[model samples]
Target: MTDQTEPVGEVDALMRQAALDAERLLSGLRMFVALGLGLFFLVAVKPADALQEPVLLRQWAFAGSTMMGYFLLGLLTWILSARGLFRMWGVWVVATADTLFVLSGLWLSLMNTGLEPGAIFVFPSAWLVPLVLAFAVIRGDPWVMAFTVAVLCLGLALLAIGGAESGQQGRRETLDLFLSLPPNVMRLAMIALAGIVLVTAARRVRRLLLRSIRDARSRANLTRYLPAQLADDLGEVGLAALQRGSRQEVGLLFVDIRGFTGMTQEMPPEKVSEFVSDYRRRVSAAAEKTRGIIDKFMGDAVLIVFEGDGAARRCLDCGLMLRADIADWSKARTMRGDAPVRVGIGMHWGEVFRGVVGDANRLEYSVFGDAVNIAARLESLTREMEMDVIASRDLIATAKAEAGSLGFIDLEPIEVRGRTGALALSGVAKDAPLRSAGTAAPVSGSSS
Candidate 1:
């Protein structure tokens, strides 16, 4: 079984980072609110001391202290984010602390000012609860939003109960003054409504984020078996396209590392893995450069396909590049006193059936047709012909690639296994140069 810890860990880390970013954004807004409130107290309100009372001065001091605490908490949030510790746990701790701060500040305001329930509703700090709720919702976690709402509601309920007990007479006296609108009831109602909306929004947002993370992880996993571009294309195809198979004329290219079995027989398993890894990387690079999509890796061979316009030309170009790349790799290995490497490639162009197959639970995208079989046979025949690269004559003709430009030697038609009539083909030397379709001349080589 393939170990999935690495990809899962990566997705988890991204989610944590996103959560931290949301926290920092909310913290910055909190700091701005604190600064605005502090400035309002210092600049907007005037001290009317005609009655020689110090109540206003004390009120200013309390408000300043509360705002200072808010600012400091925002700063702490920033510090935690900088240290990379503002994750889910940090969210719980910081949210709890903020609830306590707001509750304590409100309690002190009620005790000192003797404000009735109606007056408390108009206080600047009363809006902090909704702001905190908004922050929790933006964090995209339903549980965190639920916790914030519970704490806010519990604190407010406790305060309301205590206020009613102590100031029953005051509220009763004002009952006649404000008969149509009850501030306490309305305030609690608004809190409930906001919590419902915010929590619902948070739950929806959480679902979306979860889905996006899953999609990103799926794309990453696909790239492990397919090329990056092909993985992206598959994602765009979606479930509908995958459910229905499609057929199109495509260029098929098969590549196999020559004598790989004999080479690995004398080497350690680690060395064999290194050799295969290097070979696959080189093949992938060549395929990408030529716009070929790798179909699958069959042990020591790689099957790639090219579709869309000019696929045949792309397949031929990929084969030539693969030959050159392996030649360079073989020379480097020989210099290092390592086993010399060689690779074989076969290219053919024909109609291919391409789509997802297998059961619903194990659907796989694949290519199937006689063209694939012919490409495989040609790759196997490379060993018998003592050549590194071979392309079907039909592929060369379809691509309109000049033999001189491709620097390939035209070879006699050879019979392929399980196919009627002989198939004409051509071979290219491993160290050929890249050139356009009509400008360059062919390099002399034996057709042996």
Candidate 2:
């Protein structure tokens, strides 16, 4: 059986890389936030005013402990990512650590500021709501964000009730505190609102990230069946273009490896696959240079379509370039002690229908009509005529003045299979002497 491990390994590696990158980002943000919070606490405490309220020392102590805890946690997360352990549930570790730190930081802030009239309390602690929510967003999981918000609300409610009781206030005063509702109710409402906003924002960002990840996966999958450029265009243009069949004049280029079947008959499956893959890669590279969209691959043959203005010219240019590319590729293969490869290509330009085909569950985008058929017939004629490339007279004529400059050998009209009349064809030798115009030059220095 063919090995499937390589592709799976690649995907796993990509996911791990994404996770590690996220961990590193969160770690840096954690350190910055911790340091900022520490400075804020230091400024609020005002060492000069400490003499006036000896209680301020306790506040400073709490702030110091909270900040130090945050720094240590951040350091731990960074080390985990550096050691590559962050890929093993690092998101959860960061989220849990950050959630706890924020919750504790809120409590410490609340206690230090005090609940008494004329003394700061809820506002200082409320600043952390957005920070914790920010952590939720960075985590990129709605459940984690929701969990953080829920725990924070519970913590705030407990702190409010607990602080009022701890003051040893009378039952009436305790009831009055709950009913007053300015700081407590308002603080809870703000937390809820902030949680809603942050969670909504996080969910939106998570959706976008998910879409990007899905798109990447889809592109990877599509490349297996379609040309990379065509797959990308399909994504950009959307399937709607295919759902409605349309006809447009397009340049069709059909490429088939000469003697590929006979050459691979005696080879092992692995070697055959490798050889075909290498040939396809070279053809794809050359075709892409001329803005050709790969229509499909049928066995050892590739069908490419060139649409829009100047399609015919691009198609012929691409064919000449492919001839040069194959020459260099064959030479490199011979140098490496491998069998030299040869290909036959045919170019035709005509109106073809483009649309989606197949059932709803397994729809396919394809092109049809005489344009595609003529291109295939010409490709087959390349072998019978003992020529490397062939172009229909119509394609040459449609290309304007392009065919004349390339020095193509005109041939008599030849009957093609499944067609009533013979097609006027011209042949271009693979090693045709390069003209001064250099139309057949390979687009890139490295053909392989």
Candidate 3:
């Protein structure tokens, strides 16, 4: 049994690890594509112009220098992508390189004696590309986005002001003269294209912001079920898995504060709320610590699920630790002349159907199966059998022999409802001495 189980566990572990590796690979691919495409656009827009003659060789050398700077910027982007670094420093590096490349081209265009109308349009477009790319890569930082927006606005404003100044000097054609012509139409066309790009980028950013907000809310909700580490894993894996149901064996646990109703009856509404809140906090802490998913909270009860024995054992340990903590809490409350609370916990191992359920407006990621039913029944049985903790025969059989040393004692076989086969019930006393195995005893209750 151990041999067969061990291999299956190893295979599952390997598959999970492979999925993580695949995600990292995809992220790297996206980074490369983003950089590569940006570079391709830059090169396509501005081809190096050729020069002739000895006197013009100096001009050629100057043009070559600008092209060299552009290539260097691309090289820097590739290097950053290869390093697999994600930080503000990388954003700054890329932004600086891109700015320098744009400014160099702008300077060359300004110095050129015979600048074509096309060159003027291309120069600003080149600057726009890098600014937009930098903004996209570092959108998480508000400062970066602010800087990009400021720069684009400043650049456009300066162009408008400069055009106005040139028109006023009477050295250039009047603003109206250019506006009425076919070349003016081309200039308007370029401006229209740039406007489209800006609108598209703004829409993209808006969608991204909405997604970020939704993700933050989803994560806050998920933390109710998962620990910080597991929550991070789930987020990295994304919501697609939850949307599509998956088949897997998982350990389910159900816990209820025994005598909670009686305790609540003895207190005022406010005091009852306080007590329930404290109980939830304690149980939630324990569940998260053990990597158990608290599927649902029903009045005074909590339904938790563990992925496997490793997770289940952790949950068991958490339950034991929680019992000790609650005992300490009860003692403190008694010392202060306050009320105490008792808790009943049950665990079972079985295959579960896990997925998102409900309508589009109100969907929830949950687990459903006979395993969940059995775990609930076990919790219900805890009240009848006067046991603080109860587990199924499946859990007991799967548990390591050392687990029995941890105060797990096999109880009598009992038939559960909706099932033809009888099951071996087990119990572990809250304050029982560790490593003591007691005799199995029959339980007297109808299976839930």
The models' CA-based lDDT, in order, is: 0.71, 0.69, 0.57
Clashes of each: 0, 0, 0
Q: Per-residue alpha-carbon lDDT of model 2 for 1-448, expressed as tens digits?
A: 1122445676566666655666676676667666766655555455665556444465556657877887787788888777777664657666776666656755654454444432224344455667667767665556667877787777666665564223633334433433443334434543554565456556656876899899888667655555455553555455566567688888999999888878999899999999889888877886778877887778888998887667888888888877777777887888898888888988898889976666544555688998888888889888888888899988888887455558689877877676678888888866665332236332442435
Would you estimate the TM-scores of all the predictions?
0.54, 0.52, 0.54
Residue-wise lDDT of candidate 3 within 338-363, one digit each (tens)? Answer: 87667788888878898666654565
Deviating ranges (above 4 Å) for candidate 3 = 1-54, 57-230, 336-340, 417-421, 434-448
* TM-score for candidate 2: 0.52
Q: Return the TM-score for candidate 3, rounded to 2 decimals.
A: 0.54
All models, RMSD in angstroms: 14.7, 15.1, 11.9
Model 1 Cα lDDT, one tens digit per residue, 224-342: 54455455455555645654778888899999987778999988889889888988888888888887778788888999989877788888878876666676677777778888778
Whole-model lDDT, model 3? 0.57
Which residue pairs does candidate 3 place in steric collision?
none
Model 1 quality (TM-score): 0.54
- Whole-model alpha-carbon lDDT for candidate 2: 0.69
Q: What is the lDDT of residue 138 in candidate 2?
A: 61
Better of 1 and 2 by lDDT: 1
